[model samples]
Structures are given as C-alpha cells and as structure tokens.
Target: LLTPAVPTLTGLMLTGCYKFKAMKMDVIGVYTNKMSTDAYRGAGRPEATYLIERMVDIVANELKMDPVQVRRLNSPKPSEFPFATACGLTYDSGNYEAALTKALRIARWNDLLDRRARARQEGKLFGVGVSPYVEICALGPSKAMSAGGWEWGCVRVEFSGKATVITGSTPHGQGQETSFAQIAADRLGMPIEDVVVLHGDTNVAHYGRDTYGSRATVLGGTAIVMCIDKILAKTRTLAAHMLDVKPDDLTFEGGRFSAKGKSVGWGDLAPAAYVAKNIPPRFEPGLEASSFFEPENFTFPFGTHIAAVEIDRETGEARIVKYVAVDDCGPQINPLLVEGQVQGGIAHSIGQVLFERTVYDEQGQLVTGELMDYALPRAHDIPPYEIGSTVTPSPSNPMGIKGVGEAGTIGATPTIANAVMDALYPLGVRHLDLPLTPEKIWRAIQSGADDRGGDRIPEADRSAPRYTAADVGDGALQVGNV
Candidate 1:
C-alpha cells in the first residue's frame, strides 16, 4: 500500500518556496529485506524540505549569490495566492517573504555574518543557515484522502448550565483539551471553566476522522463551531417562544437571550429544554448538536527558520548558538500553545539531525535497536528558541486556522543540517550524510573529501549535471532511473 508519504514527496517538495514552471515526481517503494519504513514526525515533509533547502544553498554557493535573494526572486507574492503550484496542489494562503524577513530580522542576519567572519579570524568555524519552508496540512477534503477527511464534534448544554464538548479528534498531548474548550467557551459566551472536553474514547465520539496532519484545531475545532451554531439556532427559537416574542426579536449575549427588557439565562433555558413544558412548537426537547466538518482544501502553513552554529575545529563538535523561527499558521487561538508545539517540534528535529539514528549490520540485523545504543536528544541539547509568527488566516475554514504541530519539524531539520554543512564548507567538505555525528565531521575535516569520496572542487571550477532537451517531455522532468 502506498502510504501518505508517497504523495507528500511531490505535493510538498515542489511547493515549499519557489514557483516552478514544471515538475514531476516518481515514487518507487523498494521492499527492503528487513523492516518497512512508516510515517514519523512531519512524514515526508521534512525530507522534501531538506532536499529543496539544501539545493538552494548549493545553488547560492555556486553562483556566489545570497541565498535569501535567490529565494525572494523565486517566491510567489502574497497577492498571488490561492496560488496553484506545478505539483498539482493549490496553496490556501501564505506570506513566505514576510516570514523570511521576520526570521532574518530576529536572527540579526548581518550581525551573524559578521560574527562568522570574526570566528574565522579566530580559527573557529561559525556558520549560519536559513531555511524557508511551507507544509500542507489540516488533513483535507474527502476527495483527496482515501479514508475520509472530515472531523466530528458534538456540543451539548447540560441542565447545570454547563457545556460538554466531545470531539472525534483524539489528542495524545497537543493540548486540544484546553484549546478546544477555549474555542467552545468563546462561541457559547460561557466561562471556560464551565466547559468540559472529552476525546480519545471511541465509545463517546463514535464518528470522526481523528487528528493527524495538525487537523485538531482547524478541522476539529471548526466542527465544534458548526455544532455550536446549530445549537444556538435552536436555543434562539426556544427562547423567543418562552418570552412570547419573535425569534428575530430575541438577541443572545453573555449566555442569555433578551427581548423587551426580559431575559432568560442558560440556567433557565437548559431546564426548559429538558422539561419540554411549554417549549417551542414542534421543537426537540434537548439542547445538543453534532457536526461533521469537511474542509474545502488543506491549509498551507509556511515559516522561516535560521540557525547559527559554532564548530570546534579540533573536536568537530557543533554547538547551536542561536535559533530563530518565524511561522505563519494563521490567527492563533492561544499563542502559548503554539510556542510549546513549535519548541517540542524543533527538539524532535534536532534529535533526527544531530543525535538519533537507526543502524543495521551487513547481515541485515538490527544493531542500534535499544536506547543504550541509539541516541535521543536530552533537554540540554536543545538550544533556546526565538519564536515569532505572522498571521495569514486560511480561507479554507471558518476559524481561519492553519496547522503548527509539524511546522518546526518540517523547517528545523534542513535549517540545522544546512548550518552544519556551512560550518564544514570552509574545511573543504562538500557533503555529508546525516546524522552529522562528531566522528563523521572529524573524518571529513581530515580527509577534506565529499560524501562520495571525491576531492573537493573549487567554487569557480565546480559544475553540476544539466538536463538535456530529451529529459524534458510534456513539461515534466523525470529524475533518476525509476
């Protein structure tokens, strides 16, 4: 079976930053002798981002041009969105240049360059890397997903004048409980403490497209909003009946319905809904609603990440001195939650780039299968992050929310890898595979060789292979021997 990662390879890769005239992607899933690969954090997005961002740096280095300038020249302007990419996906909304500019400003880009120069004078390796990335998320419309791409939410007002929200989107630890409650409470004009959110139980929420691809807030929260609207419509009609006024004459505010100097609060309305005594004609005797929200399209969350690193010439140990990330994931419901998600995601990316690795011997047996053998990042390994955001509300949903759960992971891997490459570039190291371990860096520094064991070519003399006319057919360029 083709996993979600397959389409992600093409859909996300070509649309990260640049606007390509034409593109093609071929997926060849080789069945290895050992275990099969499955989805991880960011799925295929991190790999796609790594490929494009690394190529941007390579192109910049070869042409002696600023990578930032190259990116700006290729990126679509803000007015150009709902931009359709050559990869057969349309971006809902973004301000790629704005995110990039904010990240650079926060990182003090020019000052970082000067610091690198000074470090070089002191016989140190200081490198700065920037990666601007865009990820497709909010799971999406049913037409695009095989399993179905809708979320379920139910809101029921209890007799106690409190609300209970049951969502189909399961939250392991993304703080959906708090964020969803906040969303529901605001719409109901009730105290947040009066709302209770429940999920992760199939018996409770029997129908839903559970959370993945950062759809909890966008798809799931929108579903809740839809349910709330339905509940309010019924409540207004019932309230007008109780007040002996037209539904249009009744206004709702602060959990109360008012008409002509008379008002009824949720406390009174809830009991009336259950009692069924003199309620609205032909109306249901309960205050509850359920919704299944299917989004029109996926949300596009873009961001810029900048990393500053210092490499020890003798030990080949790289230390991240500074990190800045500026993301645009639409209007945040809770800024603190966004920051926590980004910070956790960056830590996950750092582990993949610098520490975590899986190994197999020539005999195809697992080697680093245990924690003692494999590595994971510790708290100290994560550098302090400078978090920032630019709001570009998505047009795909009523809440205008985009996803942020995977943005840091999607952007940080390339940013950190590029920084390490930049630091090793002066030592004549052209390329190195991850996880950029200390031994690998030291070996590369000593041999001054590329990953393929070729001698490093000078910038002026180096040349990349060109695609011929035969390689282009129907505006698509097939890469590799697949």
Candidate 2:
C-alpha cells in the first residue's frame, strides 16, 4: 500500500549518519497473504533509526572505537546547514553535535561509564547506549506529496476583540488547541483566553491536510501566522487612517496601534472596522483573513537519546535505569506540550522495543490478535526521563519550528535497543530482532545465537489449539474451541 511504502522508502533512504559516496535502494512490496501494513506512531522512522543506530554500535564493537567518536567523525558539521544527503533530501537546519552533547551531559556519560564498570565488577550486565537521530517532518513541498502538502488557516478577530482560528490541521492529543492559541495570542498581542482554536470539523474548516507527519504546528501554525500578518496589514492601514498618521508611522504592539502621541487599541479599532466609519477608505468591513502555507522544504528535527540499561544475569530481564533525551525541534511554542508529546512518544518506543509484537501462524492467521496476547508497556515499565532541548531553527517557516510529535519515538527506540544490544554484545550476541523478550535474551546468552530473523515458536506449539472468545455474558468471555 502507498501508506506502507512511503515510510518504508523514507526509512531506506535515511539509514545512516555518514554521508556516503554511493548508495542504492530498492523497494519491492510483496503480498504476504496477510493484512497490509500501514503507518504507526513513528511510521518508518523508528525502523530506519533502529537500523542505523544498531549498525553504529556494531561498527564500534568491531573497530574498538567509541560510538560517540564514530558519530562525531562522520557527522556533517554545523555549517553544513541545507545539507543535502546522498539519498536526495535536503536538511533545512540542524546541530547534531549540540544535541548529542546535551544528551550526554544530562545523562552523565562519565558517571554512567563508572556505574557500568562497577556493575560489571559485581557480575552484572550493564551497558550504556546512545542514538542520534534526524527525521524529516513538516511533510514537504507539494510536489513530493501525493496529497497536497499545504495547510489552510483562517483567523477572524470578532467584534468583541476576541479571536477565532480555524485550521485544517486536526489535533488529536498533541494539544494543538493550546499551542495554536499561544501562537495567536502572542502574535496578536491579546490574552491567550481570547483566542479560540477550531478544527476537525469539515463544515467549519472546509479545507485542510489534516495533521499527519508532524505538520500541524509547522504548516498549519504558519498558515495562521500568514493570516495574522494579512489582518495586521489591514489593521495598520485602518489605524493609520483613524489616527491621521502615515501607515509606516504607526507601530502596533500589545494589541494597540500607536503613533507619535495617539494610540488605538483592538477594542477601539475592531468595532470601528465593522462600523465602516472612520476607517481607511476601501477597507474590508470584517477583520478576518485566510492563508494557505506551503513549505518549500522539509524541516529536519535531530536529536540524541541516551539510555543506561541493566540486565539481570539470572532472569534475562533488561531494565532501563536512566534515560536522557535532547531534541531540537527549533523553537517550542509550548515547552509543556512538547514535553508531554516526547514523554508519550518515549513510552510508545519502549513498548515497541521490549514488549509489543505481532505474531502469525503458518496459515497466516493472527496469533497476537488481542491485547491479552500482545504485551504493552505499563506505567511502571517507563524509566524517569531527563529531557532537554536545543533550538536549531529551520529556515522553512518564520517560526522556525520543526515537529516534535515523532521525535521521541524516533530517538528512543534505537537508544534502548542499542543499550540492550550493548549488554548482550559482551555475551557474544551479535544481532537480534526486536521485542527482545526474556526467553530470547536468555537463549542468546546460553547459545550465543543471533535471533535476527525474529521470534520463532516451535512447530508443535504453533499448531496447538488456541483459545478464542465466543460470546460473553456478565463480563465473562466464553472460550471457543480452536
């Protein structure tokens, strides 16, 4: 499916940190006689990041070089902004080294090394892992997207001096309402409560790209900004006419327009614009504007995530003792919202790496069809997160914001996986597929085998009859014979 293929191709192109002299990729979508795969939280980004980060660790182990040094030696310098990858995408702006530095400092890299040594002395399998990831977001130019890449925004300053922002980008739990309000309030110099954000209603917001690929804030918010700029232009003319001053002479700030000695606030001018009296000649009656913003290039958000993992020798259980995430999504409109998104994404990553999995039988029947069979990370499964940020503004938009929606998921998956792999590397385990289960780890430790293919159930167990729910009464399910 196009949905699956897009991310798959994206991942294939972005599988390495170093600039390669030559590279080739082939995408062959085959029918597995199973349900079609589609986009997930991080889509292809997590898979791509996992591939590169694990390979980096593997190379480090082989060369006896520090993984950090390997990264530093190969990464593009900060001056290489608008850097073009050999794979055919141009990064808007980034400071990969800065993010890495911040993450390492926050994670206390030296102390972590000492701790790992001490744990080893105690006969423990302790390891530290670091992953620096850059992901393409804000969708891109319209030519690259099957669907239109631009987003629409409408801003209307009501007669009561309150504002309403209608955007095509629909926000689910990413808190776009609050963030959009913040943007509008800050730009209009009005109270945050005075701005109301509306979306996800087709009748209200007739046109939109509908908020995927972390384009809500970058594209949609920028559209709102464009609308605000248009509205301000009209307001400036109206204020200049009313104040009997040249438009260039009037300065607008704090919801008020001021001249040499006279000023007009929103309360005075908003009603005047509608009243059509004492306003600029040929001025629009309503204080409203709409804009559609199409970004010229994709904004690349890069970050570094470090994880300290400790494995129990006896049980094969791996626990993350510490985690540090330093991300750069340009400037955060709301730090709280960004933090919440990152925390949720990190939890999602943790689930994907250690717990979540989908299984199938020889007949292509779904084995892990329900939540009871598929394990998800619980509240206690997450480690305390040390979150930090670097601000490397993208030139794609005036706000300079990239997207943080998928940053945590993209960065944390490989960070934790690399840590687990690092711990197993000492035991002669070279490679393993995801959802590093206890049994798999224990078997690897015992046999020194690589489970790179995936978890395989014994044929007898795979063919065994399994329980399925029939009808349920009184909240009790009746088990049906398989």
Candidate 3:
C-alpha cells in the first residue's frame, strides 16, 4: 500500500501501522509518568508486536481478510531504504517485504487453510501467525548520547603487547569477548588469539557510565581500531630506524616490517633494536597504544518472524509447532557466533510467552520463589526453529556491522503468543494474558458453553498446596499427601 504512484507519498506512510491495517494517530497516551514503563525483555516492541499480530487474526475473522494478505498490505517495500516510520525511526536499511515473503514461504502460509481443514476433520484447532519487527540498537552519536547519557570506550594496548579493553557498557550475556578480539586482531594485523578483551572491572577496564543499551560494538569496536592505528604509527618509526629506511618507506604486514619489497621483517629487527648493537639508540622494546572512540549515531537492525501452533480443544493446551525467523544485523563478523545469539534470544522469548512471568500475591509476597514455581520453559518445550537472515550493512562504523545480541528476543515472543491466540479465536476468545496455562485456555475454550463453564478445576490440577516457612528442614520435608 505504501508503493504510491507519486514517490512523495512514500515518505509519509505509517508503514508499521499500515501493515497491520490500523491507525491510532494518538498513541502517545501510554507514555504518562505513573504507568509509563520500565525494562523487560524486548521492551515495548514485545507488547506492540503482540497487539498487532493478535489484531490481524481478529480483523481477518471480522472482515474475512487473509492474515498474510492483511500483513502484506502494510509491509515496507525493499526499495524503501532510509524509510522513516511514524514512530520517528529512520530505518537506515532493510528488505521488510522480502523478509515477510521468505518467512511466509517457509511457513507454508498458503497451505495453512488445507492444514486447518484436515485438523478440523480430525478435531483440532490449528493456526499460523506472523510478526515483522525492527530494533533500533547500538547506542552512540554524542547527540543521541547527550539525550540519554553517553557510552564510552578506552582501549589500551600495553607496552608488553597485552590488550585491555575498557567500555562503559557492561554485558551480562552478549559475546563481547569474541567480537572485541575480532576487531582488535584484524585492525592490528595480529593473531586473533593474541588479543585479550577486559571489561566490567572498573578499577582495571576503567571508564564511563556502563552497558545495557547495546552500545558496545559500534562504540567499543571502533575504539579498538583507533588504538591499532596508534600502535602502527610507533611501530613504523621503530621499524624504519632498524631497517635503515625512511619512515614512509616501511610497511607492516603479516606481523612484521618490510622495507618496500626487501625481505627483512620486524621480528628480525627487534633483537638489533633491543641490543642497540646494530641499530638506532632511541627505539623502545615493545609496541603499545590506547584510544577512546565515540560515533555520531546509533544503527538500526530489523527482521520478520512467523510462528505456528496447534491447540488441543479437549485439554485447552497449546504447543508451538514451528518457529521461523529472518533477521538482518548487517555484516556478520562471525556467522556461527551470530546464529548462537539469535537462537538463544528466541529461546528466551519462548520462555516468556508460554511459561515465565513474575507473579506476586495480594499480600505483596512473591509467589514464584524458585525455578520450579517460576514456570521456565525447558529444552523440551520449544519446537525446532529455522533461523536465517539478510544483511543491510550499517554505515555508522567502518566495520559496517550492527548488533545481533538482542534481535531474537526482540521479535519472537509476540509471534508465539499471537499464534496461540489465533488458535483459540474460534472458541470465542478475544484476548488472553501471557503464560497461557492449560486451565486458562480451557476456560476460554468453554466460553461459549451455556450449561457449565467447562469442568471445575480438577482437584488434581488446582494450585498445589503451598508450603510455609515452618513446613521444612534443610534436607527433609513434611507432606500431608504422598
């Protein structure tokens, strides 16, 4: 729908809202002080994405629009590079249309009706749901930072050639080690294993505010490159003195210095410079450098995801059958490591959708104390997922890279929850809270009943009796039943 006959109109399209076929010109109502927000996985995107996806099925049933077609109507086209969404984010680069198209093809969205018919013939509720989203990440640009504090990095390559990286960003799970090493080694032309990453020790890694806003890569990685440049400058002077050549005549390569095609290297020149025997008297024993880098703006990474599910009407239970994700984080430094980040993030979201939620009692006592009571999704809970991507390099850094650490968590939860609601729609359910427990789904399944609201909580399924502080010892417990 955004592909207008007049190119000027494309600039004003509300792509995300258009894609969902909904318009709320006054959505800023949720931003008030008291009820505004706090942090959670995926932040606000999870809630908004869930809302759109659930509404897709609802609108489909109401006006009979096919869910996929309804989505296609609003998807931003591949040609919309640097497109600006009404939310005020300039999507630097993306292929939203292709991502959605690929996701639907993989999900076999066209055959969903046939499968649903077969399932109905066999007495089951089946449905497919999709959510396409984008993440604005890699905090930076002093102006962006000034708006919300700033991110800082101080990279030092010691006199001993040992490296220590200090950044204001602290990572709890993102793999900064691997990424930092790649940046340092490639820039210095040293073996990757020789570069060491150090952070989180303010006394050692010393510097700014801290991580959490995903600022490490664009800011921190660029600082490593700057430090390498400093090291090369000093090393070149030392190399020129030892090689008996002009400073500009020497070049460093393969971890050594060469005099413009002459066969001598920096290793061969090191011993002479150390002894002051056959070399200049003013050179140092080892290479070292340090730097602090701050960029001009944050980069954006985006993607699309599709979730499919099956609901058992008899038990009111739903299970994710398949999850398909397509993400673009721009220029991967390590594909394997990137895939690991995406996969782990999706699992985190899956746990949130069907199993995990922080709960508190009326007395203000925390109810879910232990892992067992918290309802975490284990390995057996998630179905196999197909993860793929497309690259749309970010121009914010020389490496042309963007962050992938939180992309999966940013897009998967809503996709799964939306699918669950789609499966239960025929049962007269319009909305359901997350952690769709079987009892809640079963209650929704029986919403159309006139005689009874399904069976009462089977005594077996009622909340298991609660244990009190007086009921147990360190290694032994008292039980009334069993």
Best by lDDT: 1
The C-alpha TM-scores of every prediction are: 0.92, 0.91, 0.77
How high is the CA lDDT of each candidate model? 0.84, 0.82, 0.64
Model 1 clashing residue pairs (backbone): none
Q: What is the lDDT of residue 280 in candidate 1?
A: 73
**Superposed model 3: Cα runs more than 4 Å off:** 1-38, 111-113, 145-150, 154-168, 233-253, 256-259, 263-286, 448-482
| Model 3, span 257-370: residue lDDT tens | 777566344345444444555544656654545566666556777777888789877887778888899888888878887888789879888887877766677775677778
For model 1, the stretches where C-alpha displacement exceeds 4 angstroms are 1-7, 449-452, 455-482
lDDT of 1 by residue, 13-123 (tens): 655788988876766566678776677778888888888888888887776566777787889999999999888889988888788888877887767777776776676
Worst 10 residues of 2 by lDDT: 473-482
Clashes of each: 0, 0, 6
What lDDT tens digits, residue by residue, belong to model 2 across residues 1-482? Answer: 55556665465446455666566666666767788777778778888888878888777766656677778778888897788888788888878877887777787676776776677667678878899999888985799888688999999999988899999999999999999999999999999999999999999998999878888999999999999999999999988988999999988899999999999988888898888877666777989999999999988898999998988777778899999999999999999999998998999999989888889998889999998998998888899999999999999999999999998999999999988877765456667789888777777766643333333333343223111111111111111110
In the predicted model 3, the residue pairs found to clash are 19-74, 141-296, 168-210, 169-211, 170-211, 257-266
The model with the greater lDDT, 1 or 2, is 1
